[model samples]
Structure formats: structure tokens, C-alpha cells
Target: MFIRNERSIKEFIRYYPVVSTIIIIHILTWLLDIIPIGLFNQLYHLGVGSHWGLQNGEYWRFITPIFLHGGLTHMLFNSFSLVLFGPALEEMLGKAKFLFAYIGAGVLANIATFIIHPSILYSHVGASGAIFGLFGVYVFMVAFRKNLIDSQSSQIVMVIFIIGIIMTFLRPNINIYAHILGFVVGFLIAPLVLNGARPYYPPQYRKSYDDDGEIRFDPNRWKKKRFSRKTKQNFLWTIIIILVVIGVLYNVF
Candidate 1:
């Protein structure tokens, strides 16, 4: 989707302003820590940060804090995830839809954390929720949109996704629910973007995959151009449902 090569990096910066701006903003936001102490707080309260207080009248909280972070590691992990997952999703959906999905997932995930894990002294900050949204978007596409990713690649991606989830649970200080909420939001809305995005693949490539992810094609199934909407719904819903269940149980016991 996005080439990490030097030429492609320049292209992304020039062409993909939304994603580029997001990456830039997140980096600069992390650098805010180097500034004086109370200065960050002064800037944080201009109705940009999301917390339970968002419901009281701070509407911009839905979008602003997507740029903020907690520490060097927090910012780096999220920035890496965004760079990894964002380009293709952004390319597939176009800039507007891409940005909408990013912010939408972030806002909803923040709201979930606000509702479910509020604290007076602590705050939920970071782009992991939004990055997880991109994470889910990629996973949903690979699973349901046949040949959007080949079987072997998709299997590897799922393994990586599972590991990320496992790591999320290991960090008790983090708001895991926010990540789940963002993932679910991205999964549900991916189909809408797919409809608008043009298809990409090698025409010579056969549509082939067995239940176990081995390449076993049925001619009847391959004849179709793309999977049906119902198929997309079923696949993404099942993944997110399983994820949410695991997250809930993790929090509970």
C-alpha cells in the first residue's frame, strides 16, 4: 500500500497530506514534553483533550487528542503502527474517508474509555486507538476482500495482529478497551470504504484459499469479482466479536 522507500516517503509526504499531517502532528505533540511543565497543560485544555469531561461541552475533544501521547515509547509504538497500516487504508479509501475513519475510530474509542475507565488524576492519550482502527481495517480487508491480500500474507498479518493484542493486555496501565472499541469501529465501516475504492490485484492470480488458509480454489467462488457484502459483514463481525469478548474477559478475570 505504502512504500517505505525514500522516494515513496517523499511521495507520501507530498500526496497524502492527511496521513502525513497526522504523522507529523503526532510527533510534534510528543515533543511537547520537552517544553516547560505547565505549558503542556495550558495547551491541553483548549477543548482538544478527550476525557469524561468531553460530555460537559468540549466537543473538539473528539479529534484533537489524536495527536497527543504519554511518553517516548507510547508515541513511537503508535507512530510505527500508523506508518505500517495507514498508507493502504488511506489509499484505498481516499483522503477524506481515511481521515474520517481515523478520527471516528479515535473519538469513539476515547468515549468508550471515558465511559468505562475514567479517572480524575489520569488521562487517556495516544493514537493507538486510531492506529488500531487502521489495524482492523487492514485485517478486515485481508480476510474478506479476496486477493486484496494473498492467503500466506494474510496469515502472517493475523499472527502479527494477535501478538499486538497480547501485548496490549500485558500493559495494565493502558486502556485496552479503547483499542478494542477502535478496532470494532474500523471493522464495521471498512465495507463502506471498499465500495468506493477501486480494486487492485494481478488479473492472472487465481482466487484460491481453503478453510485452513491453504490455496484451494473453487472455480464457482472465484468467478465472482468480489465477495458479497454479507460475507464481509460475517467475517469482520466475527473477528471483532471475538476480540471484544477476550478484552472484556481480560478486564474481568
Candidate 2:
């Protein structure tokens, strides 16, 4: 379920519009921030998760920071995480429910951050909270709703989740409160939205065979071979390793 089968960016977007749109927004806002025109400086000042802003009734800060990032590395890391993880949930929960869960987790995480850090100057940004929320949903599926994911994917989720939790504590400037609370919120909200949810199967790889008495006729043949389960597992593990290296580098620099 964690494997991505899309051959191109267009196909990826077509299959997973919600994840695509969120990533697009991340890139756009990040571009705005770095454009050197100072046009979006107000966005940085107003949209960051500032306890001061929340106290003064700028409630949108909760939602806005989910789409904002502090730098290229910040945006790319979260976007890569989403690209790797978000499609399965989007496919399982449907677009609307997936959006609800994502935004809900992020907003609640920001609220938790505000409550946990009472100082007026405390502020945070990035979608790490929301990304952790995605991990939370996977954790719920892996633990309570086993049928929703396969054994391999569950192992991947648990490994990544554990690594993520460790990194949350190890990384400097990390918003521990947002990450933890977002995960909790996602775990709690999973049952409400996951009714009738099923494991993800990419449309392109779906095939059916028609039985003609003793022989089966395969009607849907593709020029390219589909990925083996082992191949996908290896690829995912490679990504996990790369993420670990990146996380370590992030801590160093």
C-alpha cells in the first residue's frame, strides 16, 4: 500500500490530487517566501503558529502553518514524506475524509502547541505535525485495524514511526508538542473516518482474469512489468535510510 506505481508526475497528480495539491501549495508558498521581493513577508509574520497571534484572535495561524515552511529543506522533507505516505490514505479515506483528517490533525496540533508553550513569543511552522498525523493514522491501522494494511507496510510504518519519534526528540528546533499531539489526534480520529476503508490498490496495476472452463484469459496486459512486493519493500527501505541520513544531516547543520 505504501508503494507508488505512477510513472510520471501527471499520473501521480491524477491518481492523488489531494496529496499533489498540498505539495503544490507547499512549493508555492515556499517560493513566495524566497522570491526576494518581500511581498510575502506578511505571510511569514502573520501565518506562523505564534501563541501571540492565537491569543489576539488570529485563529487561522493554526491552519496556515501546515502549508508554510521555514526553508527549502523543511518544505522538501515534509513534501517527500507526504508523497511517500499520503496517497494510500487518500485512496482509502477518499479525498474529503482524508483532507478532514489532515487539516484536523494539523490544527489540533497547533492548538496543542499553543497550550504547551505558553510564552507569547513561541511560534512554529512546517507540516511535520500533519505528516506525523499521517504516521498516526498508519499506526492505528497497523495496531487496531490490521486488515487495512499488509504485514510489510505495517512493519514499514512502525519503523518509520519509531524513527520519527526519536528524531522529534533529537532534532533541534523541532516542535515536539505539535508532532506528538498531531499523532495523538490522528490516532483518535482514525476510527471515526475509517469505517469501510480498504487497502490501497493502484488503478493502473489492477488486473482481472476471465476463466474459460480450465484456462484463464488475461485481458489486461501492460508493456511494462508491475513491481514485485520485494522490490517495493527494498525501495521503501532505501527511502527510509535516505530519510534517516537527511534527518541526521539536518541535526548537524
Best by TM-score: 2
RMSD, one per candidate, in order: 10.7, 4.0
TM-score of every model versus the real structure: 0.71, 0.91
Q: How much is 245 displaced in model 2, in angstroms?
A: 1.0
lDDT of 2 by residue, 5-84 (tens): 78999999998999999999999888878877765776666778888888999999989999999888889889989999
Candidate 2: C-alpha lDDT: 0.86
Worst 10 residues of 1 by lDDT: 199-208
- lDDT value, residue 243 of candidate 2: 84
Q: Over the stretch 96-195, how does candidate 1's per-residue lDDT look in tens digits? A: 8999889988988888777776664546677878888877777887878865755644664576578668868875777688788988888888787677
| Winning candidate number (lDDT) | 2
